[model samples]
Target: MTNFLVSSFSLSAAPRNSVSRIQQELTIAQKQVATGRFADVGEALGVTVGRTISMRAEMSNIEKLKGANTSIAQRFDTMQAVLETAAGSGENLMSSIISNGSTDEGIATNRRLALANIGQLVGVLNSSYGSRYLFGGGKTDTVPMKSDIVNDYATSQASGTVDTAWQTFVTANAGGDPSLVTADQMKSFLDNEFAALFVTGNTDPALNTWDLHWSNASSSQTQARIGESDLITTSASANDDGFRNMMKSYAMLANLSGESLSDEARQVLTSRSVETLSTGLSQVTDLRSEIGIGQERISRANDGLKAQTFILKVAIGKEEEVDSYEAAIRVTNLTNNLEASYALTARISRLSILNYL
Candidate 1:
């Protein structure tokens, strides 16, 4: 008789291997049901796994940009507040001059006001946000002005280039008594010598008062990256024309207030101060508008990033997330299959000559 023979070792090994395979499948299904995602993402996604990885990376980048944008927006807000306060101080100075007239008492009072405003301006420009000076441009760690503008003006008046220049102007014009100089002569000095000191591009040590004594701010502004390709200015410089001009106007009033000048000279000086202040106010307004534009651009960038994040999340979910209800059903089936496998393994283990007894 022809009979097929199978080894007892083969029978036992097949059943044991089947039980092991079923146990592994049950574990995977149980994990999927518990987590609502594929237990083996790379295995299930196969060659398409790269797409999910790319989407996840993009989402991470967008989140990082959004976080940075929050700080940029805050910096812009601080700058706006500072500029607004400076503008208000300018207005108050203008009002003080206009209402106080040109009498000796008025001049004294106005000098006090100008000095106070100078202090305020210096403090605002040196304003710091979390250890960084806001108006220092790219040199955020440095204080923009080493001292108050008044102190620098006083130093120049006492024993510096400004004092030397003033004496030279008086000598050349044969105008007796520096304090009693005529209006026309004072105008010429202001137009030629004093105004030159505050010009933004002037690098002459004898003329550029701002660079020599007043400011330590960098000309290069600070910037921030709010998006993948978007960059915007995030700081203002104390070395700008607006700030310099304002300081110059205040210096003229404060320095001349304590002097014994002719009525005509005082009138000319007051008129020039008013004109200079007006120009500085206009420039300060422009700076405020620039910060506003940056804020708007940051808002737009944040909106775009938020939208991109939403889209990427949807794509990632489709690739990695599993239906919980379906996974639960699979878990039940896998459990029953594992139990049947174990039963067959037990039956095979019992098949021996001793069972036949």
Candidate 2:
């Protein structure tokens, strides 16, 4: 009587539900086998899921830092190349000054050379990396130096403040001829007037010349974070004493080339230009060293980050990783269970009261 009361709906529904559940478990096991990780990490890890999340977050951060380090290393390399070019230009100018810059012919030749070097130096200082001006300090979006500064100075040499100052010196000394000007007088003009033109932050309109003509760089240097707590200077400024001194050397030569000078005055100019250029070149070398040091620190930081990345991966593996062998065995068991359930469902569906009789 109890067997006669069995319902057809209950017989089919039980095996149908069993097949559906086994299919779902098989799908999960197959996924775990393929990925070698938990199919439901949160479900499996429970409260320990937080540790897995934290480790994955740290891994993501390390990857981002590694990418940043790569970009910073490239920027440092570009800066090194530009500094090398600037140093070469300075050396060429120093050689010209030391060799034969005092004679009229030599002055003309050296003036042309200095002009060329000025263009080259300006081009390098105004150099860019991915739309950012490398020498602009924090003002990376702006051009660091005037591209036409050399040309502008050349065009205005006769009409600008430099000529005005020279005219005043001539009037004071009561001399119409530049050849009649003494070395000490030329020294005063060079040290006082010409030097003023290149000086930064002079309130006087005549002396505030560098800002007006040449440099647009910020006084602040560019800095970058290579690590969580490590910040380093990443760029050189066009307004640095090194760059300004270099410009001073080139400007003095180019502007003075047209004037007829006494041998003593020319000698004084050449000597001073040589000293300025040598100092500038030395400072350029120092800047290169600074960039090199930053590069070294980045290299060391990356090594440490890589080590941490490896450690974090191992730690995460302990919590989220699944054994592929075990997962494959589970998949096989689930597949067999699903097939048996499917057969049972088919048998239950074919059941009839007349067949049982």
Candidate 3:
């Protein structure tokens, strides 16, 4: 008791829509085969979109960290080379003084060589990388030590503030011999005018390079991000006790070079001078050792960063990469479906009103 009415136009339109959908699927599969990565990452990763995005971002950050770490490591290497060479020169100067019976000319000549070596060391300390001074701390644009440090020292020591005090103490109390200056007098001079040159950090406006007005001692150092969870620091300046003691010894030895004193005075000066220079050598040696330790830490951090990068790459690849074999199979199936759709459409289009009747 039911009458069925079906329009040919409606029937044709429904098949056409199904054929269009099959063609669209075929196009997507072909694109997946051509590009190893999904054409639509969000559509391909449906529920895992957030996680894939995070992993990719982290991998990008790790790449940037690796680049920065390479630069820090280079600075560390240069630091070690300069420190070792300076320490060696200090040690050599002390050794020559200890085993010398040469004339004042010989001593003076040695002092001249030492002065040049000290100046070279200062240049290394102020070395720059890409317009930024290595030892300048937060003031990378500024030189950390005065260019005329040796000259300033000569002026200060000769003005009776340091040399005169030592000379006066030795003359009055040291048996009329300048070389016989006692440790008390030496320490006193160092505590007063001597330490004034370097101690408590050079905050004087007159001495801009030696100024210690940094946010913090460590702030003067370079902090590098080697990994997601790691930071490495390295820095050194003329104010470091190692450099201070070494430069002080050099200055004093240089001053003694110009003095017209007896062999007894020279010998006395030489022995006492040898002692201080030896201590400076020890401090510089320790700084070189610290550089070795810093290099080791950076090496370890680099390894960790590499491992993290690999893990992130693997995770991201799984979410975004197209499976070549699977994609090929899907392409074949879609092609067949499209061909069948075309055949059906042709057959339907061929069926006119007369054929239907």
Candidate 4:
């Protein structure tokens, strides 16, 4: 009968509450670490490493494209300057030929000298940028003028006469003589033939007959086209009337060997030379303008690419970067909650049913 009055005592909820709070803090810390928001040491280390890797790749691509754009622009600029010089030289030579009558032996000498200048101009037409021939059309490895001397001319040897020889040269080598071939022909027999040769029927957009070419191997095919014209339909049987007219004019001038020719013949030949040169200049100018247009297009495309690359970088940054202020606040709050939880848990453990009794 000495049984103590049975009293049921329940433990206070502080211990459970403290455990729950501590668990919640741990969850928050885990989430922050995983999402890269809070500055948990492990999470911060991981985020920094990943972000550095992503940013390096993005930056590298941007830099590479930028360099390519610069190279393309510089090449176009150089081509423009060269064309300008060629045009000026042509004008000066034409003026000299027109003003000084061929009756003067000096006129023939001057003509030969001018022919040399034209040969120089042809050399310019065969200019290159990094291994690419600028004027060989799609054949970027071969020069546009193989020889500037008429005697060394390929077509002249084949045809035996200047008129027939050049026609043969153009037809056989250039696929067909261009309508504007008069000005492009060799000035002397010692000069090499002027013809555009390309890999047969190869119509790659970047490859034109005026461009240089090497082996058909993939490694050697990185050349670019520089000249403006590449006829889609080339025919030897069909007459290049424009080219024929130009050659006729050149032949007329070439035949005037001595000062004894009639005044009318001299006048006609001089007039023809002036006219042919003028026509040739027009063709060259037109081609140059076309090149300018191509250059503008490439520049615009490069600018657009740059803008897009910048936007991509911004997007990448948003996805990977952490806000330091937000991370710091979360870390502080988590630290405080964990400390409070621990204190509350200790206090609860001491308040058992026996302690209360």
Each candidate: what lDDT? 0.82, 0.82, 0.68, 0.50
**Candidate 4 local accuracy as lDDT?**
0.50
Candidate topping TM-score: 2
For lDDT, the strongest prediction is 1
lDDT of 2 by residue, 1-357 (tens): 355677898989999988888888898999999888999999999998999899899899889989988988999899999889889878877787778747767788888888788788888888888788889988888998864563555655322656677777767874678888888988888898777777775557565567676788876877777777888887778888888888888877877756888788888888888888888888888888888999999999999999999999899998899987888899889988888988899998999888968
- Please count the clashing residue pairs in each candidate, in the order shown: 0, 0, 0, 33
Give the alpha carbon lDDT tens digit for every residue of 1-357 in model 1: 899986677898997898888888888888888887899999999999999999999999899999989988888888888888989999999998999989878889888888777788888899988688899989999998865443544554322544566677776775547666889998998899877656555555565566666788888888878888998888889988888878878878876656677788888989999999989889989889988999999999999999999999888989999998888888888888888888888888778866568
- Residue 70 local lDDT, model 3: 81
Candidate 1 Cα outliers beyond 4 Å, as residue runs: 1-27, 33-35, 147-179, 203-207, 331-357
Worst 10 residues of 2 by lDDT: 150-159
- Please list the residue runs of candidate 3 whose C-alpha ends up more than 4 Å from where it truly belongs after superposition: 1-31, 150-196, 201-220, 330-357
* lDDT-better candidate, 1 vs 4: 1
Question: Clashing residue pairs, candidate 1?
Answer: none
Clashes of 2: 0
Residues 1-357, candidate 4: write the lDDT tens digits. Answer: 586653232233655665677677767655665666443434545645566466657667667765765666676677778767767766776777766765576568545645455445545655677776554444556654434232332233212344454456557644553332333233332134322222223467354322232112121223332222211110010012222233333333443323243454455446656776677667667656766776776666566667767876676546555665675576677777777767865665565466667
